[model samples]
Target: MDLHKPPAGPPAQPPVPASAQPPARTPEGCLVVAIRLPVRIVVLVLVLPVRMAWDALVVAGRFLGDAVLGPLGRALSWLAKALLLWPLIGLWRYVVVPVGKALGWLGHVLLVVPVVWSYRQVLTPLGYGLAWLARGAWAGLAWVYACVLTPAGHAVRWLLKGIGTVLAVVGAGAYTAVAWLVRFLIVVPARWIHAAVLVPTGRAVAWCARGVWRLLALLVTGIGVVLYWTVRILVVLPALALWRWVLAPVGRFLAVLAREVGEALGHAWRIAGRISSAVGRLLGTLFRWIFVEPVRWVYRTVLTPVGHAVRDAVLRPAARAARSVGRAARQALAAARETARQTRADLRRMLFGESLPREAVGRREPSAGETRTLGRSTTALTKD
Candidate 1:
């Protein structure tokens, strides 16, 4: 399968650009136009200096980051790797790894193996013995519960039931006697006192209380009526008039002024941004003409030519000489290596004589008779 092959489909068309898709614009009023112009003019005047200052700060920050901070950060990173990272890596790899492996092996042999052996040989059998003893104890408990405790529990329950019945009968007789005595001695006397003496006294007291309450209600009503009119004339009416005639109108006017000021500030800031951009471009052009252009011209016309001449006249010849020396050194080293290999081979042959050559065997195909079947064994144990 050829994975690099393109799909058999039509190429996609390019998307429409944002400039080609213009948005709808709403119409504005004369008031907005009048406000916008003056607001924008004032805002532009105010914001231009701030925008320029901000741009200057941004440029300075970028220059510092590129020219100073980037190189410093890279140098620090390299120093940290050399001083801290490399040594730690070497220690972990060479020292810690070997020691950890040795400790692990020792733990497995001296501690883990013995613990595992003890658990299997000693603890496992002990647990089984304990389990067997527990089973015997449980059976004894079950027998005792069934034979002795169950009957004893039944006898206790019956005895408690008989005692409870007798107590209930006695409690019922005592309750009836107490209820009879309370009704005659206490309840009858309280009922007579309430009917004969309390009833008339209560009725007289209630009549007096009603008359006092009526008198008090009339006085309170008269005072409340006077207070209502007095408060209405002195405080409530004046407050309402102030709110309607003065405060509400003032608040509405203030709100309108605030809205206009907010709108003016917004328009002014946008205009200021455009003005600042134009000023920045003008300054940048002037700077390029005054300083950058001359420097660029000098570098291109004079320095470039001088540098080319120096490279051709001095550096090229030196580089050629260095290359020649390097080539000669490499050739000499290669010749020395070849001589050493030849010397070692000659000495080995002198000491051990020439090695014997092996005979080459021809390849052959197996016959039908030599091919083993499922019923016949071809292994060494049953070979023919």
Candidate 2:
């Protein structure tokens, strides 16, 4: 039996089915389940209303969709057919067709006609003119380039190229000589001095820089701490004191005052509302009792009876008398008009020798003296 070697044993057995196994027991779980069962009942009780409402809502939706939707959809379809489709068909047939035709006519007349005219008359000729002008400009530009620009550019390029190269060479040589001389006189000495003196000086400066940096860091940290404490002492504590001593108390007092004022206002408002309600009720009662009811009573008890009596008694007699007066006046006026016509005719016959209408009555025509007397009477009546 080596330590590393496994001890061979029986093979592992498959687990038993839960139905075949004995039930596991946990007292704590039973206790927890007992506690949680009541909690679940409470939760169910709490959620019962919301769940019922949700189910009711679902039922209502189903009812609306299953029962009401068909009629509503049919109504909407009928409206669409009657109001939308019919009117749209009519508009397309009558109005839209004519408008489209008019717009097409306008487009042809205003846009197409102008475009065609411009293309033929203005744009075509202008294009030819521009082409000719462009040709002339091209020729001129070619001539100027050939005569002036090309020669000038060549001459300038050659001069610049030659002079720049010579100047650059001389300047480069001078710069190289000056560079070496400066290096010999200054840079070499400076490098030697840097290796000998500057290295130590730089180390001293670096050490000083580190000391200064450490001091600055300490100072900054100390300043931050001091600032923090100062703020706590100067600003924070004072703010806390103000809040505790003054602001909080003031806020509480203001809240109490506002509540009192609101309560007073509410009380006053209720009183005023009651008073106004009473006044309105009194006024309504008075109006109904003194005006509406009394007027209705008077109309019913006195006015209607009086009106009927007057219609039967006074108005009937008056209407008959008016009719009699009107007939008598019409007959008198007609008779007077006939008499005037005869009299006027007689007067005309006397003055202008015109025969009187019904010239002789019973062979006793009116005499001249009678005619003259009739004329005078007629003139007086006309004057009157």
Candidate 3:
């Protein structure tokens, strides 16, 4: 054997002759072969209408997207560009750029150069001179304050202080003299008058007032006593006798009569109240027997049973039926979603000329346990 080549095994067997090979056999049973024609017929009949409708929808969708919507979108885009872009380009080129350049040139000439020149030549010198003047003026003012005005201000302040001290001393002494004179002339005299003349006059006047008050009190007392005896003799004794003899007996009789009447009236009021109470209770009993009790009977005997029957026989089953319908709709929607996902995968493969990438969908079929659980749930729903 060569170094690069592997060692050979036993020699290959010769090809089998065609006549010696057994023929392939068909696996179909008798029943399947017998029913095959009917199955094919039924399948074809079902598929024909679906195929026609699919072809029509595909053609219509393709025409709308490729012919109508494509041209309309392109034309609208072109019109939008024509409306929006051209005017902006023209304005920038013909108006805005030129105007901006002109304004820039004018500003450079009129504003920028003048400002630079004035700052360098005019404002610089003027500001320096004004600064110098301000410095000189400040120096002058400092000299006036420190060397000339300060000592003069001190001397003037000393003179003014001396004058203020003199005025204060004179004012204090004058105030003291005037105060002493006021005490002698006004306060002393007023005190003497109050102590000597006013006190004695007030005491004499108070004594005379007391005497007059006592005299008036005695006169009033004498008059009151005289009036009391006169009224008793002339009026009070006669009135008392008349009341004792005439008015007292009449008042007693009237009071007794009023008390009797009050007692009778009270007794009649209580009797009337009792009768009214009895009548009210009787009417209330009658009303209950006639109306409210019958209403309660109908509700308890008729309406309640009907409501229970309706709920048990009609509403509960109806609710279960609605729940079953909802469950069926959800199952159908899930099936449709899975079908749509498969269709999308097929479309992706067709459109992209690519092999299928995901084996997850193929592997995602429910397990046997899950299928049994689903069947059990479906059976339960049906039974319900």
Candidate 4:
């Protein structure tokens, strides 16, 4: 039989008896159900003990934590008291009390001096000067007003105007006389005197200037020689002595200052070293008491118990659950791989004309054996 040959019979139809057709089965619907009702009940039973243990552990952890923290809180309270209370007491005793007493004494001493001294020395003289000036100015203004504004003042003003006119006429005559006298007597004689006096005065001034210049030059040369000798004897010798004296004092002061500063610095360094050592010891003690001991206690009392409880209860169960999930996932992956491999093999067999498994290709009724053979023959024609 040819595998590619078509069927010769007509198609037959099934009789319809159902009210409705059933839904088609999908690939997802073919999956096997692994978690059954019994497994779900077993999972619930296993989780119950873990939850109870976790709740008990949480209660125990809270109790242990409170117990550990209680001592630490009290210690912190004592530390705060030491840091704040002692310093406050010292400030009140040392600083505030002494400052108050000193201020009170200074205030009492200040009250002893005359309070009016400031006003008398600083303000009263200035006030008196101002009053005197104001009185004088007022009196002068009153006298001027009386002189210029009264009836007698008008007559006196007229008399003064007449006297002024007479004086002006006299002054004009005197000025003309003085002008003529100056031209005749002063100007002519002044010109003759100037001409007569200038030659001798010039010669005298030149002689005096030459004499003065020579004297100045001589004095300057004497001064220069004297200053040179004086500088060598007096200025230079004294300057050297003063330099030595100044340097001696300065060097002594500097040496003393250096020694004092060295001593001070050494003392400060010793103090600082002592303070540093004390601080280091204090910090070490604090660390041991505050951090190390408490941490050790917490680890032993609270954390250890809590860690053990969590490991036994929640962590162990969670780890087992994760492992079970991983195993299930691996099994599912393996089954899926097997299924994929089987499907690939079946598809290969179908497409490549290979025989499939008897289960995959269903069994059918036997029919007559019909075989056909194909042959090829050659016919030759010869020409003579």
Number of the predicted model whose TM-score against the real structure is largest = 1
Give each model's whole-structure lDDT.
0.89, 0.82, 0.82, 0.76
Residue range 46-71, candidate 1, lDDT tens digits: 77777778877888999999999999
The residue-by-residue lDDT of candidate 4 on 137-177, one tens digit each, is 99998988887668687889999999999999999999999
What is the C-alpha lDDT profile of model 3 across 2-38, one tens digit per residue? 6797678999899999999999765755654554555
RMSD of 2: 24.7
What stretches of model 2 exceed 4 Å from their correct place? 1-28, 36-89, 184-186, 205-384
TM-score of each: 0.61, 0.39, 0.28, 0.32
TM-score of model 1 vs. true structure:
0.61
> For model 2, how does the per-residue alpha-carbon lDDT over 1-384 read when each residue is reduced to its tens digit?
567977899999999998999888544435444444454455454554555455557767988987999789999999999999999999999999999999999999999999999999999999999999999999999999999999999999999999999999999999999999999999999999999999999999999999999999999999999999999999999999999999998897676555545555545455555555566588779999989998999999999999999999999999999999999999999999999999998998888996547754543433566554544553444543
Regarding TM-score, does 1 or 2 come out ahead? 1
Instruction: Return the clash pairs for model 1, or none.
Output: none
Model 4 global lDDT (CA atoms, 0 to 1) = 0.76
The lDDT of model 1 is 0.89
Candidate scoring better on TM-score of 1 and 3: 1
* Over 4 Å off, model 3: 1-226, 238-277, 308-317, 341-384
Predictions: Cα RMSD each:
15.4, 24.7, 45.7, 48.3
